[model samples]
Target: MAAAAATNVGNTWINIGIFAAFVAVTLIIVFSVSRQNKTAADFYAGGRNFTGAQNGTAIAGDYLSAASFLGIAGAIAVNGYDGFLYSIGFLVAWLVALLLVAELLRNTGKFTMADVLSFRLKQRPIRMAAALSTLAVVFFYLLAQMAGAGGLVALLLGITDKAGQGLVIAVVGGLMILYVLVGGMKGTTWVQIIKAALLILGAGVMTFWVLANFGFNLSAVMQEAVNMAGENGEAILEPGLQYGASAVSQLDFLSLALALVLGTAGLPHVLMRFYTVPSAKEARRSVVVAIWLIGIFYLFTLVLGYGAAALVGPETILAAPGGQNSAAPLLAFELGGEILLGIIAAVAFATILAVVAGLTITAATSFAHDIYASIIKKGQVAPDGEVRVARWTVVVIGIIAIIGGIFANGQNIAFLVALAFCVAAAANLPTIIYSLFWKRFNTSGALWSIYGGLISTIVLIIFSPVVSGKPADPVTGLSKSMVTDPSIDFHWFPLDNPGIVTIPLAFLLGIVGTFLSKERSHPEKYAEMEVRSLTGAGAEKAVAH
Candidate 1:
C-alpha cells in the first residue's frame, strides 16, 4: 500500500511538471506572435505562405493528434479488430480531399471554406451558416481533445477521479486559447509541427521496443492477444481467435473504417488547413506529403495497439489512467519503465495541445474571416479591424469550448470525436461538395444542406447510445444511455457514424432547396467556373467567395 501511494505521488509530480511545461511553451509562442499582426490575412491565414512540407507536417500534426495517437491505440487495445479499422478509414479519407476537394477548395476560395461555396451567392447567410457548422465541428472536436488531455494528465499524474478530468481539460483549453488569441495560425502551426515530430518519434520508439521484445512476427502478437482475451472471456482479443468473430464485431469494423475514410474528407478543421496555403498546387502537394507522414504514423500505431493487447492485458487498460486512452502510456511504462512512460505521456499531452491549437485556430479564423468580415462587417471591416476581431473572437470561442470541455470532462474522447465527425460529414461536407461541382446548386440549396444536415446529426446523437436518452441524470450525474443498455441496446443507426445516412440527407436537402429557389442564373457564371477550375484564372474576381 505504501509503495503504491509513493508511486502515485511520483506520477503526480510528473504530470504537473509536464502540464506546466506545455503551458509555458504555448504562452511563449502566443506572446511572441501577438506582436507582428499587421494584417488580417496574416493573422487569420498565416499570410497564406506555408511551404508544402511545413503545411504537410502541420496537417499531419493537426489530424493525427488525440484521435490518431491515443484514441486509435486505445480502441485497438480494448477492441480486438475495431481499432485498426480506424487507422484504415483515416488514411482513405485523405484521398477524397486529395482527389476531390483539395484543388477546388484552394482554386476557388481565398481564405475560409465558405468563401469557396458562397462566392456566387449571398455571402452573409452562407458565411453565418458555415461559421456555425465549423463551430459545431470544432466544438465537439475540441471537447474530445480536452477530454483526452485531462485524462492523460490525470493518469500520468495519478489524479484518477472525475475532477482530475476537469483540471486537465481546463489546462488544455487555456493553453490552446492562448495560442489562437495571441499567436494566430503562425504560432499554432509551429506548435503543431513540433508535436507531430514528437508523436512520430515516440510511436517509432514504442514500435521498436515492441518488435525487439517480441521479434518481428505478426502471428505471435495475434496469438498472444487471443490467449489474453481467452483468459478474460468477456474481452475481444485473445489467442486462437479470428477476426469478425461475431456480427457486432463485423459491424464495428465496417463502421469504424467508413468513419475514418469519409470523416477525413468532411472534417472542417482539416479542410480549413488547406485554405491556409497560398495556391491550389501547394494545397495538392501538401496533401501528398501529409499522406506519406500520416501513413508511417498509422503503421507504427498498429504495432503499438497489438503490442498493448499482447503484453499489457485488456483489464489493465481499463484500470489505466483514462480508460482505453491510456493504452499507449501503459504500454510504455510496462516496456520502458517510469522515465520512458513519462516521456510518452508528455508527447501525448503535446499531441493534444497541438491539435487543440489547430482546431481553435480553424473555428476562430472562420469567425474572423468568414462571419465577421463577410457577414457581420458586410465586407467593411478594415484590415487592422479584421485581425483585431479575429483575435478577440478567438478568446470568445475558446471560452465557450473550455466551458463545454469542463462539463464533458469525465467522458470518452473517442466517442465525442466520432460524434463530431458524424455532424461534419452530415452538415458541412454535402454543401461544400455540391456548391463546387453542381452548377445548378443555388443559395437556398446551400442553406438547407447546412441547416438540415446539422439538425439531423445532432438530434440523432442526442438519441444515440453514446449520449442519448435523458439530458443528464441528476442523482447518478451521468448521461442517461439512449439505448436501454449500451451493450444489449437497439439503435436506428447501425453504427456511430451518421455520415452514410446524414450525408445523403444533406444532398437531398440541397437538391430540393436549389430546385425550389428560382434565383436567376448568371450566364457569365459558367465562363467564370471554367476559368476557376481550369487555369485558376479570374484572380481579380476573388472576394469572400
Candidate 2:
C-alpha cells in the first residue's frame, strides 16, 4: 500500500530537482555568510548582528520543524480536535519563553545556556551538568528532524525500502554538518530565515486555496471532512479520538500538554537564539515577532488538516510511505498534483535541514564553550581553538543523529518531538528557573536539578508505553511502540510521556538540594546577575569577554 501510494504522489525526479535546487541555493548563502566567521562569537551567535525582526523570522524557522508541517497536520486530519491540541501547546509555549526567559537569558548568557546557569554557581560542576543536559535535549530533537527528513524524501521519491530511507537520512546529516562547520551560526541563521519565509508562504497559499474550495466557509470544510471520514468521522470532529481513551490516556494528554507548554523556554537551541541579538530589547522584540509568525502558521495548519481529510482521506494517509507524517505532502499532491508536491516536499526538506543545523550548532557550542573551554581547558583555550572544536563536535553529533534517525523513521514526528520537549522541561527548565529567580540556588541545586531530572526522565521514557508494551494497530497490524516486536512488553510506565511526573520532581530536587547544601550562593554574584539581567549593563562586555 505504501509503495503504491508513494509512486502516485509526485514525479520522483521533480521532487529531487526541487530539493537539489534548494540545497544549492542555501549552500551559496552559507558560504556567502561564512566570510564573517573570524571569531567564536560569529560561529556560535552570528556575531550578534541580527535585528529583532530577522531573528524572529529565523526563530519561526527553527521552531517549525517537520512536526509542525507533517505531524500536526496528520494528527489533525486523523484525530480532529485532539490533534489540534498539539498546535495550541506549541504556540502557547512561546508565551512561556517570552515572559519567563527571553530578555533575561539574552542579557545574562554570552553563548550557551550554561553561561547563564554557571554564572553565580561553582562553575566547573554546574557547567558539566548543564552541558550534559543540553546534549541530551539536542540528541532527542536531532533524532526527530532526521527521522522526518528520511521519511519525507522517501515518500516523495517512491523509496519504500529501509536502506533507501537510511541513505536519505545520512545525506541529510552530512548536509547539516556542512552547514554548521562552514556557515556556522551566521550561515545557519540565514538558511532558517529563508526556509521560514518559504514555509509560511507555502502554508498560507494552501490554506487560502483550501478555504476557497469550500466557499471560504470553515464550517463547510470541516463538515465535508466529517462526512468523508466514514463512521468515525464524527469522532474526528470531537475531542478524544486519540487521547481520551481511559484514565491513563487522559493523564498522558496532561503530560503532553505540560511538556509542550514549558519545553520551549528550556530548549537549548531556542534559548541559544536569545544571544544572537544585541540587547535585551531586541530579544524581547524578537520573541514578540516569533509569537505572531508562529501563531499565524499554526492557524493555517487547522485549515490544511481538514482540507486534507476532506480531499484525500485518512486511510490513504496511513497507507502512505511515512504514515501520519505524509499528510501535508499528500495534501500538496492532491491540491496541485506533481508541481505542488515537489514544491512542498522541498520546503519540508528545507525545514528539516535548517532545524537540524540549529540543533547541531547548539550542541557543539555547548560542548566547546562550557565543557571543553571552561571545565577541561580552564578558559585557556583561544577563540579559534574553541571554534575548531565546535566544528569537530558538529561532525560527531551529526553521525549520532543519522544513526538515531534511521531507527526512528516512520514514527509521528510531533510525538517524537513531544518526548524531546519532555526531556527539556524536565531537565533544563527547573534549573533555569531557579538560577534566574531564586537567589539561594547553589551549585548543588543546579547539579541535582540537571542530573536528577535528566536521569529520571530518560528512565521513565525507557519504561514508558512509547518504548514498548503498546499493542499493534488493529488495522495495520504494526506495533505502536518504538520496539516493534510483539513480545516486547517490558514497559512499566502507564503514560506515553513522563512530563507530568518528571517536571515536578526536578523542581522539588532543586529546592531540596539547595536547602541541604553547605555552600551558600555568592550574594555579590547574584546581585551582579540580577543587575545585568534586568538592565543589560554588563551584557556587552560579557559577550566581548
Best by lDDT: 2
The TM-scores, one per candidate, come to 0.89, 0.97
Point to the candidate with the largest TM-score: 2
Candidate 1, residue 522: lDDT: 53
For candidate 2, lDDT tens digit of each residue in 260-320?
A: 9989899999999888888989999999999999999999999999988888888888778
lDDT of 1 by residue, 390-443 (tens): 778778877777777777666756667887877777787788778767778888
Candidate 1 — worst ten consecutive residues by lDDT sum?
1-10
For each candidate in the order shown, give its overall lDDT on alpha carbons.
0.74, 0.89
